[model samples]
Target: MLPLLPLPHLNREFDYLVPAEFDEAAAVGVRVRVRFAGRLVDGFIVGRVAASDHPGKLGYLERVVSAERVLTPEIVDLVAAVAHRYAGTRADVLRLAVPPRHAKVEAEPVVDPPKIAAPEVDLDAWASYTHGAAFLDAVAAGRNPRAAWQVLPGEDWPARIAELAGTCAASGRSALVVVPDQRDLDRVAAACEAVNGTDSVVALSAGLGPAKRYRRWLSALRREVSIVVGTRSAVFAPVRNLGLIVLWDDGDDGYAEPRSPYPHAREIALLRAHGIGCSAVLAGHARTAEAEALVDAGWAHDLLAPRAVVRERQPHVVALADSDHALARDPGARAARLPAIAFDAARNALKNGLGVLVQVPRGGYVPSLACGKCRNPARCRRCNGPLALPSAPGADGAGTPTCRWCGIADANHRCTVCGSRTLRAVVIGAHRTAEELGRAFPGVPVHTSGGATVLDSVASGASLVISTVGAEPSTPGGYGAALLLDGWALLGRADLRAAEETLRRWMTAGALVRAGADGGRVVVVAESEIPTVQALVRWDPVGHARAQLDERIEVGFPPAVHVAAVDGSSAAIAALVEEAALPDGVEILGPVDLPEGQRHPAGGGSGRDDGFDGDVQRLLLRVSRGSGAALARALADAQAVRSARKNTESVRVQVDPIRIG
Candidate 1:
């Protein structure tokens, strides 16, 4: 029996007796219960042997959990491969592959799939893109191809994705399209419905009820859907005769799984394509450094558009520091939250009966609170938590400071460094921006969108819409003007991807503004010379990503080299690193302690600058790309040895972590 237990010591299968009553249900892939460790536990039946292999008598299975053959052989192999590659346990990967079984859903009726023929469109529709037709034709002819696409602005990307999916379906092959989230999936699903019928595609997501999710999963397994569109987990959808896989907006953090092994959606999609010998397309508005690495390694072709065409389609972006020279003489321009140019643009847009969009860094009133005198961040004395102002204004029109981690009020607290009781907002949020804009533009309506009450789109009107990054809503005719605030908060992050991620976020919101020829303007309040700001102004995300990749290669950072992170107690991490026999060209860095504090998305880590914790430390291992497999095996062996010895120390191994910090 294939035991479900994931303990490192009991990873392999064992022999078990099948009673006569349960013989009919003892099929491969069926879950069964057996007596293990003096109690009943679930296990899968992988194979039936003619005779017992063990020398001694074996124990009988407690009972058959279900008769459904849910674990397919192909999926089992994929799970095993992922576990080995990440130095993780097979059972952990299996948990991500299959969800809890719902017996009642097994009897539900399958919906009949809609029948619709693929539609033919003009190849000129891909005019802005380079070699677009070649990629599509290759997929249509069932030629296994791979590409990394840098999508241009103002392009009908969803329609193009649908065209590709329809081409595969017309060739008698199934396709999978994985986007970042449900909203993006909805957009692609609509485009697919226009090309193929609504019934030809099915969506799989964990957001649905257990019964509904299971029903959709079963449909895909039964080959009832020709096209599947979903978020990360859909990479494993059992599409019969799979021929193509597409990953959209690969740079979005939503594509990164937070669970054990932490397999990225893009990597999983790449693995599926390579294993099944199918076409794969990785497309994003602002490509990531990792994608550029694939192109450098000759694993995928570079798909790009000409600079002239891109500039023409992009909005006229200007940095305040470059456009307003006289303001620098005022001595206060460096400290001004909103520059004069940005304020003027918003005022003019309102006067013309046009909408204005303001993109803030944080979501609430004040995500970071600091002392007014010393500029040191305020913290809770009880738990050492970073203090934040209440999301809403207080009864007296003042802000109340509260610990973000421990949820304790500290309105009367004083700064330990400078003994100042007055607190100021170090990083402003959407609510505060709305309050300021409402007062600045009197009689104009001010709408806010962020958190759980985010709006999809706003109607055309002479108003101001304040939203945080990634929460900016669409306008009917596009916003007449946009103001990108708090550029320092995004650029000052200590993480490696801070600049790249900031550019991506800025471009995503900037793309919503009307073109410059149509009287639309974008004003970024930041230093003009910064690489990220310059990239946004010139609309050159691909160039910036290429430069970033080159830097990483020179410094032996990730993508150029394979990296793994081990986190736990300092002793445990150090022990694991020393015990593992890493391959040549592999090096270890750091046993540094991670700050224990409440982490905010926009701002940097929250805590005292001098605070230190010695309990938990993180260690990173780097190896050449070719020696990655050897490193994985060595780490796994080390873990096995430790487990066998019943070591009290616990360590968590993660390959290709999203953030090294």
Candidate 2:
């Protein structure tokens, strides 16, 4: 029995003895029910000890939650470390480690997978993966212990994923692969089913019917098959003998588990693998700075195709500048930020017999409006409602506009910043862009992407399709030319990782362009070529990330320096930050207010701000690299002090947030 004399004020872990009957059940990595404070609570079976110092009064394990060991030794220890750093509960972290109960399998036995040869594949993915078989062989064998494989894009991605699943099956270990969205998950699921007909391969998504999803989850745990593929939450899947973990587009926000103790899929997968010593891969078309950092730090290896093996030929991308001093300007393209060169490119592509893809800003008709002179979005003085073009036709055939936030009419309203009656569109949404495209190409069939109507539309071959970044259609022969409009909005996002996010979005959309249109052209709308543009220009993401990392190190960012975020009311956040322990290495930034109208629900608070509930905001705490773990330890200490308050308030601890400000 554990010693209960020194009662920890905190509801923390207590060491206890294993009852004789439950001795076998008390082994490490198992789950157990425990009696605590006159209530039954769940606790992880961290260990089974021979003896304990506490008296006979010490409580016994109520029951084993599961007959099978849910956590590996590595995960148990990793969770402990995580708990210490983030001041998180072991139970909460365990919830992340174990996939949902429905996703857990129990009865079925794993079966041997059939042998498969190196694929005689066809894919023109850009990553210099020209030497196809060699890359496939390396990935199949799990040759690299630290890193997983990234298949060069093309039709072979699906085939390669199945092949990897087969290898996991052969190893007698279950596998899990994560993608950015449900659509990709469906594609992967279909591909896996074609190769392995059993229930072993299933996709877990809340969008699917509860019963059906639960069935798939159970099948995976039972080793009904040996692999599970899905979005973020799939990382928690409790597959047995996990041999491999794969994350596609690790950089995408979709992988960030946005909940209590928000755990990212990549970090979770890495932790799980470290716990079990399993092999894994961090793969994507273009690597992010974080991924590149991993490769550079020797934490993961880069599995790439030869320059000739993959999609070496790219769309002829041109960077267009649109200042007052442009040599040529197209009258039709003057609306929005469409440069004449981009319009000319699209015109040529259509005339030359290839379809063109026009990328726009927002999906709605009028996302925002502004004064033509001041460039300020027209908003109601009483409320911050954005004035936008209404769906209904205007009185005289022109569309009427209204404010979405406050439902205020803007049909006769003039610009607030400038007194001019004539208002110009500050941000041309997807609908506006489609309208412009329709007007420009009168005879061409103009399809729009984004929002409800467009996202639901089935993919059809079109000559001119206008779409938002993610909603770009997957056209046959691809678009002859792709134009990324409204470069300012993308580059001007208020988020800290704006540049990184913009680049990723652009690259993902750009990948859809056909390789042969006007020699395959992609026109970027930018003044000067930024780093992201340069990376796209040279297709050197690896180098791009490396450079970014070097800059981060020089200027203290994650993977270089340690940082923690304390989010709450102004007083609460400030109190915690002040009380936080510092071993002379950590630094703090910003009790600063969050970006206007952008604070997270947990991120904001009302500090009696002029009698209105306003944001409490967040502060960034930075620590020296040497004391990275110590910084986390400090935050835990601070959290303890704040928890003892009579006035209960929420204080959040995040170890490494994806978004850095």
Index of the highest-lDDT prediction: 1
Taking the tens digit of each residue's C-alpha lDDT, what string does model 1 give over 1-661? 8777756657678899999999998888888889998988877887888898699979998998888788777677777778777787677677777877898887777666555475675588766678878888888888878988877765667888888898888778898999987777888989988888777888888698988888888787777788999888888887778888999988888877666666788888877787778888898778789888888789899878888877777878878567456466444555788878788878878888889999998988898988999999898999988898767666884677889888888778899999988888899989988998898989998999888878777889888999898888887778889999999999999988899889988888887887777777788888888999999999888789899998888998778788888777788877887889989888888878755531211123221112223566778899988988898888888887788888756677778776876
Model 1 segments more than 4 A misplaced:
15-25, 47-63, 111-116, 120-122, 323-333, 396-398, 597-614
Candidate 2 residue-wise lDDT at 350: 79
State candidate 2's TM-score: 0.84
* Local error of candidate 2 at residue 558 (angstroms): 2.4
* Model 2 poorest ten-residue lDDT run: 1-10
Q: What is the lDDT of residue 540 in candidate 1?
A: 88
Distance from true position, residue 453, model 2, in Å? 4.4
Predicted candidate 2 versus true structure: per-residue lDDT over 319-390, tens digit per residue:
654343443454344343776788787887777677777777677876777776777777765587777775
TM-scores for all candidates: the values are 0.92, 0.84
